[model samples]
Target: MIKLFLPLCILFLMSGCKKSELEAVNSSPTVSADKAVEVAAYEVEAPTPPKEISQKLLPDVNQSAQPPITPKKIDTIAKKIIKNGNMKIQVGDIKKAQTQVGDILKKNNAYIQSEQFQNTDVDDNLDLVIRVPHKNFDALVNSFSDGVGSVLSKNISSDDVTEEYTDVSIKLANKKIYLEKYRDMLRSASTTKDMIEIQETIRELEDEIDLAEGRLRLIDDRVNYSTLNLSLYKEKVRSSATSKIGFGSRFADSVTQGWNSFMSFLLGIISLWPFLLIIPILIFLWRKWKSGRTKP
Candidate 1:
């Protein structure tokens, strides 16, 4: 009975020791888990870098660094231009130069619109306005400049008449259409009153068509020809004697002119009969008074 009791006591002591060791192991694991949780919270709460530094670390790709480029397009349309010119030149012989100018115009398929020859004591001048083919405008101007004489003045100008020409053309075309419509109306007329009205309308349309055609013709002429206004003059020649005169010649001419003027004055006074008689009576009275004074 004593041995059995002693064994039971030893068994009880071993069981108590085993239980204490198990509790200690469980407590150690709990402490370790709390430490791990604290470390995780500290890591999550740590401060981050400033926004500017973060932006510098990660660059954007949308912003371009190269310059923008531009390209040019070529034009392909031709412009319509009306040319005009004005010129003045000096020539040797007015008549000969006028003839030569006419010949040049004919050769260039041109015609004179107007011409005037003015001869004065000072100079002989020819003024001309010519209409020349547009294709020969430049060539004619160059030829006149080089072959005519010394140029005094030159002016060349251009106007854009394309718009005017197109407008006139469109009007002319519309008028022709109206003319055809009026003719058709005249054909469809059956009553005398209707016929008279249609005929009158046709006449009106015809007149309008004529006017439009006239305007078109004028435009065509202007477009096909270029206008040139020209003036040519002959230089006055100095007489050889005047050109060679010195001081002596000028003095002689002055004396001769003065003498001729005095003679002409005397002749004028003689022509006045009343003045002639009065002069003779005054001369006689003066002579008598002089003799009386001498006697006294």
Candidate 2:
């Protein structure tokens, strides 16, 4: 009986120990502290970094090992677009030739940007500047050459603008990016002067950039298509008075003019009959002849 009692006491002790451990687990909110520590370590492993610092750090190591890039010979960008063309026509009348030219322009869907008509002792000329769509430019030029009797002088110019255009584009892109930053700063700025300054700078840069881009586009268009310049002259036609008259034509005109002059003189004398009374003796004689050379 004593041995059995002792064994039961040991079992009771073990059971009590197990129950206390279970109670401790139930009471504690942070269970499995090792797993929690592992999760927390994972969470704290990474942190967000500033953009500039990140970029500096992440640049390729190989690129850093290489030498700096060297620039090659840069081409000149044109200040203005290259536009050149010309046309010459020989015709009996410059005015009549211009009408035909107008018709041709309409047919080709082109327009005359400017024109000047001139005539001197030598000949007649029409100087014109016409603009046609890029697609139809060549066709219109060909037609102009075909229509004209001769081509006087042809000149062309080219503007190489690759470098200037590229530089401006790069500068424009950088300016735009900087301007965005300025805008962000503006939103948070407290001072009116600072805001106005930023706005003015952005406006000026935008205008300059727009002008540069426009000039570049124009230059590109001109270089892509060549232009032809021309001068036009027409031989003068003169008709003499003798040439206008055919056989006996001069004689008939003279006779007609003389007859007209004689009739005009007779009408003038009749119209002065009332005023002739002032001329005493002559008027009296005229009155006698008018009244009596008929009466007696």
Candidate 3:
């Protein structure tokens, strides 16, 4: 009976050892799971930068570091100027002065646009309208003032037409654009009313364009060529009777005049012959009456 009790106690000790080993294994698994959960939570809370976000920011930084681009500037146009002048000069001889003026014009590359001449008892005048290149305008005026004759009056004027020219040019371009559009519309018009309206608009635009072009042409002409109104004047010298005559000539003229006076007196006596005969008849009658009275 002692031996049996000893074997039963040994078996009980073995079973208790197995139970402790099983509990240790179960606790290890629970600790491993808790470690895994903590690791996952740590990963979730930690911060990480994405390469795509860095790339996007890098482009923005590079762009900010680069220089800014500026817009290009447009070129400026030339100025438009119109010049005009009026001058009056006193000359010695009109014909000779006219010839001299012609020579000067040829030298200056100018021409007489119009010319007029007047001769009077008091003076002679030669009026000329001269057109000269803009560059040569002042030179021509100086030449005429210094060489041609004495200047009586001079007037010079300059007009700045740059603004007007620019405005007209822009308006003309716009009108041409509208005109083209109208023509295209007219071509594609499906109805008579639309065609007629487009045609009318086109006509109006064409007229405006023509007028603007003509004005520009006129302005260009005035700017390129300066106009000058030139007047040449010469005073006449009158002849005097009291001056510069030889004694012999004066004596001859006086003798001729005296002879004319004597002839006129003789003709007057011939015209009175009828009156002389009547006087004689009256004298005879008077004497007869006196004798008759004395006898009575």
Candidate 4:
């Protein structure tokens, strides 16, 4: 019993020592300073940044008074915020106003998602539909309204899509987890049938993930830009503002049109004069002889 106890105790101590050694050697896989050189490009093979670049790129890296950021850690976080809003604008001189809006959009470096412009003859009106990128949309629109000669009507609308966006994001994350689990299952599947089932489940998860991603993209695009449905018109100059033409002017126009028609009719008669001449001359001679016989 003593002999077995001695061997077992030694074995346990050896196993414990081995476990500690493994743990000490196998550290967690945080991105190292070397791997952060090209961090913006998302590469993992970067080396330690130079003192100058590190100071320039990451000023707070060595700050203990402030929140400390290690040289090896990710430098700064990137965040994207999305919101959807729209506007309705009524302005005078639609064409000129649209041109101004275009200039504003360009100045703001906004992407034109879509545009539609229509001119109406039924009434003196033009309709314009414009979608500008989300980032500078509100500011750009504000600047635009300032230049509008007179805003006959204006309206603004908004949709709070934050909750929906967050929902899809979380759902997509879970689907990725599920997809990874299914992928693992596929790799370790025993039977062919089991492998096929796992793959099928993975496919479903991928489809769901894709759908969620598409929705997210749509939300991102819509939120980034504001849509403006603008209606504007160039007012017609009414006849009351102008004096009527004098008698001389009226007579001249009448004479011009009448002379044109008369010339046209004379040319038509001359063209058929040969045929008319023969018929008229023959009738005249017959009447002359009849008159001469009656005189005798």
Candidate 5:
């Protein structure tokens, strides 16, 4: 029993020495964690800035800083106004007055748009529709009043088309811009479908542009030219050159009536020929009867 116990005590002493050696080898040197973190901090990269914060620090250099330019306002003087007028005058001689008015119009660079003449027992009336430049509108009306004859009626009208004109102008400009863009799109087109679509768009824009331009042209014409309606009249019965029947005309009228009456009487006698035959037969019978009575 003593021998067995001696060997077990030796093994136990060896195991304790091995355990102490392992503990000494596994243990690390004592150092503060704060000191270790500070030492290695410089080697690490800095934290990235937030997306919002970074944008504020550096702005885009290519962008413009100035404000956009604004368009100017249109003036009233530049507006379009259409003028119209109407006049009625009574003159001594319509033909002479018409000639005078025509001369006046020619002098003012005006022209007759339309004219009408009416014939009546009382008088011959003349109606004239004239188109003159706006500058000459009032002048032409005044000339008719002063030179043509007595002014019986006069009227003037003014129409403001500024808003409509401006609207058409703006629409025309927009269509022009759209047409340019569509043309560019057509140039860059790849597929047939894309080309056809762009071409159609361009055609539509061109049509719109044309329509707007036409409207603008009409407005310009209306504003540039003024319309005038003039009426002229002269009393035929009151005029010195009135129509009258003379002695010679009366003699000819009487002869024509007498001839017409004789022709009418001849036609009536020809239509009674059958009845006249029967009347002659009855007269013969009556004469024979009277002779027979005398014999009895």
Candidate 6:
């Protein structure tokens, strides 16, 4: 009986130890679950950083805030000048002068743009419009002045177009850039209305570009070639007989005066005919009166 009692006591102690271990294990899981719930609540209540929130909301703002692209710098340009001249010359012989002018033009690599000739009773005139290289303009003018004929009038004019050219060039370059950008936009366009607007803008830019290019071309042409207006004059010599009245003219004048005098005398005799009839009647009346008095 003592041995059985000792074993029962040992068993009871062992069972009690097992129950305590089980309770510890179950309580630990509940504590862990409660801590996890508290952590999740804290996470839900926290606010995001301001910078990170802005970045997420405005994704393209950084790109939009970037500065615009600048245009390319142009190199230093040369000066542009347009020159024109006007001259009038008198020569002894127009044909000879014209030949000399042709030779001079050949030497100077010049060409006549237009020519006009006029012949009047007293003088002959030749007008020429000449286009020559800028380098040879002065030489040609001197040659015509000294060798071709005597100068009556001379005028030379110069216009500076450097500023104008530079300004136009810059504007044209900018327009081209805008045109390319618009074309790209048109290609990527999604809406019909946007595409139509971009196309209209592109068309207008193209027209402006063309006009600017045309102006540049015209300016270049004037700068490259100089214009010269030349006039040649020749006076005709009159003969002595034509200049002065000759003996034949004087003889014809005398014959005309004699004929005029004879006609005047005949007209005077015809005017006296009416008075002649009245004179005869008065004479007859006077004779009758004198005879009556002598009879009384």
Model 6 deviation from native, Cα RMSD in Å = 16.4
> Candidates' TM-scores?
0.51, 0.46, 0.59, 0.48, 0.54, 0.57
Q: Count of backbone clashes for each model?
A: 0, 7, 0, 6, 0, 0
- Candidate scoring better on TM-score of 3 and 5: 3
Per-residue CA lDDT of model 4 for 1-296, tens digit only, reads 99999999999999999999877666423445445555755655557789778767765645545665557754332244544444555555667777886787678776555455555543356565667666676786677678755666666667777778877888898999989988888889999999888988888998999999999898877776666665555554446424576888889999999999999999999999789979989999999999999994
Candidate 4, residue 260: how far the Cα is off, in Å: 30
Candidate 3 accuracy as TM-score: 0.59
For residue 96, give model 3's deviation from the true position in Å.
1.6
User: What does the lDDT read for residue 11 in candidate 5?
Assistant: 100
* Residue 278 lDDT, candidate 6, scale 0-100: 92
Task: Give stretches of model 6 more than 4 Å off.
Answer: 1-73, 245-296
Give candidate 5 regions above 4 Å deviation.
Answer: 1-77, 238-296
Whole-model lDDT values for every prediction: 0.84, 0.72, 0.93, 0.72, 0.86, 0.94
Q: lDDT tens digits, residues 62-93, model 5?
A: 23453657889764437799998888899999
Instruction: For residues 106-126, write the lDDT of model 6, one tens digit per residue.
Output: 999999999999999899999
Model 1 pairs whose backbones collide: none
Clashing pairs in 3: none
What is candidate 2's CA lDDT for residue 19? 100
| Pairwise lDDT winner, candidates 4 and 6 | 6
Off by over 4 Å in 3: 1-75, 241-296
Stretch of 10 with least lDDT, candidate 6: 54-63
For model 6, the local distance difference test gives: 0.94
**Root-mean-square deviation of every model:** 21.4, 19.2, 17.4, 25.8, 14.7, 16.4
Off by over 4 Å in 2: 1-83, 157-163, 213-230, 237-296
What TM-score, to 2 decimals, does candidate 4 have? 0.48
